[model samples]
Target: MNDQGQGITVVSLLLAGLLLYGGAGWLLDSWLGTRLFTPFGLILGSALSIYVIVKKMGGVKS
Candidate 1:
């Protein structure tokens, strides 16, 4: 795939991660009557997505 395609894929992955995790967090907050999980979930999702992207893009060759 070309660079543009790769860029699009990365963006999509990031957005999906944020939405999926953030939405889960929001649901949890609604269910449990808390207001912290949303941010936490978003952070976790972004971090995990970054990790996945790094691995997929081939980080640090030995």
Candidate 2:
């Protein structure tokens, strides 16, 4: 794929990660009556997404 396509894929993966995990966290907070999972989920999601993207991209070019 071209650079543009790869860029789009990366953005999509990041958004999906944030939304999916964040949503889960929100649900958990509502269910358990807590107030901390959302941020935690967002952070976790971001980290996991970065890890996946790096692996998929075969690590840094330089």
Per-candidate TM-score against the hidden true structure: 0.88, 0.89
**lDDT score, candidate 2:** 0.88
> Tens-digit lDDT track for model 1 on 1-62?
66798698799889988999999999999999999999999999898888888877755554
Per lDDT, the best of the predicted structures is: 1
Candidate 2 colliding pairs = none
The runs of at least 3 residues in candidate 2 whose Cα sits more than 4 Å from the true structure, single-residue gaps closed, are 60-62
Indicate the TM-score of model 2: 0.89
